[model samples]
Target chain A: DARVTQTPRHKVTEMGQEVTMRCQPILGHNTVFWYRQTMMQGLELLAYFRNRAPLDDSGMPKDRFSAEMPDATLATLKIQPSEPRDSAVYFCASGPGALDNQPQHFGDGTRLSIL
Target chain B: DQQVKQNSPSLSVQEGRISILNCDYTNSMFDYFLWYKKYPAEGPTFLISISSIKDKNEDGRFTVFLNKSAKHLSLHIVPSQPGDSAVYFCAAIPGTASKLTFGTGTRLQVTL
Candidate 1:
């Protein structure tokens, strides 16, 4: 069965450190999305990519957060000078881009805890 | 502004009884809606979906009802089982492969 895969299931870093999370979307999927989940906000869309091009990143902190899809299979989310308030579970999801009713397939998620 | 809203933060039901989770949306442009379920350590998984043109859709034990006029939708799980206990989220999209707006999830607990 095909599934979205994420690395470093859990990460703990000190404040002001840089953190990077990686995801491997299911083969053949052309759209990738990054989301942040927190108690106060639930699930917030951070960034999304279609056809390996960044479509939207408005939800992300422009100066601190960045998302990129270097290839069709790989997507990455990075945080520079990560803050304690940035602690939350980050998820990577993918779907067949532009499908009429596309359903996203999500990875297990990376649990990040910044001290 | 929160486009999607799940009024009930949590719901508890007795096993074998029916569980109904409600969700509301503020966006009139949403044409498709979906439901997802998440466990403690796992990501949200797609459960069911309904199109704006359809008022109701059913798949086995799960059914989704949509009311376009009110911009509301609901998920009904028949004969709720203990395994059904999890966080349920409601998501909506305005166009094809567009950014999905999600609601604050409702946690469901099915007890014996």
Candidate 2:
């Protein structure tokens, strides 16, 4: 019954405000991923961390978006000066290992709205 | 530049019929494919998966078929039920790549 836990199931903020989303991956999982889902773009991987170290963040906008895993249990995605276009459902997923055959388990997601 | 694509955005099928969802990938380096089912407001749940070496994998009423030569894969659900109606996503993992490249997803509706 282990699952990835995400905080703040929904968020609404004005444009230019900072928004932070948090995730707690399943215990003993080593890989964590952050993704954004939009009607136009579908689901896009924004960033991921393996063993508490970032493996990729190329899909994220470096100027305003940041993803971090302070420890194995905590992963966070923050958007500074968030804009309306940033509105989307942010999902956090975790797997047992990096590049393993195991499927990533996802959290319910945080629905963010930037006005 | 979508490496993975689910051409059909939606599908409707009668209950007790077979539901087939197709996905095509452009990346030959992809060695593993997976199918996930997502309900509204819920996370995508892993349904089934297939490796490059295998052509088919099954779990209960769900089966996944992979065609490496055609770079295509499909998910088949037998005796589709009302509860089976959801968005299904196809995802791929390239050789040694840690992340999954997901398709746009297909919304399936089972009608009685």
Candidate 3:
């Protein structure tokens, strides 16, 4: 069964450290999404890319967060000068067919903690 | 303002009984809705979904109902099982091919 794969299942770093998370979307999927889940904010969409092109990133904090799909199979999310407030589970999901109601297959997630 | 809301933070039900989870949306433009289940240390898994054109959809023991006029939807699981316990999130898309907006999520506990 194909699934989205996220690396570095866990990460702990001091505040102000730079952190990077990577994802390999399921083969054949054209859309990739990055999301952050926290107790206070729940699940929030940080950004998404379609066909290796960023379709939206408005929900992400531009000052610290960036998401990119370098190619059809690889996507990345990076946070610079990370803060304690950035602690959360980051998820990557992918879907096919120009979006629609197609259910997204999500990665297990990368749990990050900033001191 | 929060567009999708699962007001109840948690719910408990005895195994073998029916469990109902409710969701409300503030965006009148939303035309598609979905439910996802997540367990500790894992990503949310797709449970079910419904479109504006349909008021109800079901697969196996799970059923989703949509009330367009009230801007509300519900998930009902019959004969709830302990394995069904998890945090359930309600999500929506304003239209086809649009991004999703997720709610805070509701935790469900199925006990014997």
Candidate 4:
């Protein structure tokens, strides 16, 4: 089965440090999404890319968070000057198209802890 | 503003019984809805979905019912099993947008 792969399954960092999480979506998927999961917020969509072009990122903190799909296979989410509140399990999902009916497949999230 | 809401934070059901999970949405534009199941330390997996045009969709043991007028949906698992225990999230796609708006998940525990 083709699965989305996430790197550094766990990461612990101090406040003000930079944290980068990487994901490789399933092959042939054209849409990529980033999400953050926290106790209070559950799962929130941070950003998404369709055909390598960003379609929406209204959920992300513009000043500290950034998401990019450098290539079709790889997608990255970065937090500069990370804060304690930034600690959460970040997930990456991908789908075959940018259609509402297509279900996005997810990767085992990158759990980040900022102290 | 939370467009999607799952009022029940958790539910417990005995094995071989019926398990019903409910979800509601405040957005009138939401045209597609999905239910995802997640185990500890694992990403959520798609369980089932229903479109606004249809009232229900079923896949084997899982069935999703959508009430467009009420903006509510429910997931029913018949003959619930121990393996069905997990955190289930309700999500929706507004209008023609591809992004999903999710509800705070409801943890379902199936007791044997």
Candidate 5:
């Protein structure tokens, strides 16, 4: 019964709008990851956090995209002035830290559409 | 460059048969490989995994085989069922970052 949960299962917005997605990872899990999925690029990692602290955001566009884990149970991915290229399914996953080989558990993703 | 590749975009198999899905990688540093199964409108689910140290790993009906020399690995599902119809993705990690580099997934259709 334990699983990651995400909000706003689908979203549609005009270009240059702000979009925010939220995730509630499985209880007691310390690692969370954000990924973007597109037709051309397949799946790409955007960011990851360990123990509610950002570990890697190398795949994210710093100018407009930011990810944060304000608390242990909640994580968020926000995009400001979103562009058409940003239209894709965004997924959030969580797992125990590396001490366990941490197989990520994913939530049903949020599908974003930019007009 | 695509570090991992699943050249076959899709595969079709009949029920009660074995389905083989292949994946190739270019990075030799990748020491761990995993397979995930995803249904439409759902996120990918962990299926099985094998570390470079071992050539094969199995759990129930799923098995993963790794070939270090070729930088290749495969997932075999025995007695494929219609419920097994889903996209399968192969992933690898270069180091211990917990970050996974994934390949374009292969869609499998198990028909009766």
Candidate 6:
């Protein structure tokens, strides 16, 4: 089955270090989304892209968080000078079209730990 | 404010019994709703979805019912099995393929 794939399933870093996560969405899917999951906050949409164009990133903290889809096969979410509060599982999801009702397929996710 | 809410933290049901999970949404603009199941260390998998235009959608053992007036939805699983145990999430999409706002998950435990 075609599934979204994410790199570095697990990562541990210092509080001020940089953390980068990568994802490959399912082929032929047009919409890509980045989300964070923590025990307290269920799931927050950090950013979303359509046809490699970023649609909305208001959910992301402008200073430390950045998301990009350099190409259709790859999407990256990077956090610089990460804080302990940044520890969470980051997920990448993709959908078939620009329709709200289309079901999204998600990646296993990258679990990040900032100490 | 939480747009989607799954108030129950967990639910326990006996095996072979029917399990009904509920979800409520505050956003009237949300036109699409979906239910997802997630295992530990795994991504949330699509279970079922119902559009605003339809009141209900079903696939095999899983059925999702949507009530537009109340902005509520429920997932019904018949003959629940141990394998069905997992965390379930309710998500709402406000616009066409827009960002999904998810609710805190509800863990379903199917005891044998």
Every model's TM-score:
0.97, 0.98, 0.98, 0.98, 0.97, 0.97
lDDT of 5 by residue, A2-109 (tens): 999999999999999999999999999988999998876778999999899898999999999999999998999999989999999999999876653558899999
Which residue segments of model 1 deviate by more than 4 Å? none
Clashing pairs in 2: none
lDDT of 6 at B63: 95
Query: Which is the better candidate, 1 or 6, if ranked by DockQ?
Result: 6
Model 4 — TM-score against the truth? Answer: 0.98
Per-residue error for B70 in candidate 3, Å, reads 0.8
- DockQ list for all candidates: 0.66, 0.76, 0.76, 0.82, 0.70, 0.76
What value does the lDDT take at residue B38 in candidate 2?
Answer: 97
Question: Regarding DockQ, does 3 or 5 come out ahead?
Answer: 3
Error of 1 at B49 (Å): 0.2
Regions of model 5 farther than 4 Å from truth? none
User: What shift in Å separates residue B57 of candidate 6 from its native position after superposition?
Assistant: 1.3
lDDT of 6 by residue, B57-110 (tens): 999989999999998899999989999999999999876447789999999999
* Candidate 2 chain A minimal-lDDT segment of 10 residues: A95-104
lDDT of 5 at A96: 71
Q: Name the runs in model 2 displaced over 4 angstroms.
A: none
Indicate the worst ten consecutive residues by lDDT in candidate 3 chain B.
B93-102
Return whichever of 2 and 5 wins on TM-score.
2
Candidate closer to the true structure by lDDT (higher is better), 2 or 6: 2
Highest DockQ scorer: 4
Window of ten residues with lowest summed lDDT in model 3 chain A: A96-105
Query: Which ten contiguous residues of candidate 4 chain A have the minimum total lDDT?
Result: A93-102
DockQ-wise, the better of 2 and 4 is 4
lDDT of 2 by residue, B13-107 (tens): 99999999999999999999999999999999999999999999999999999998999999999989999999999999876877689999999
Clash number for candidate 5: 0
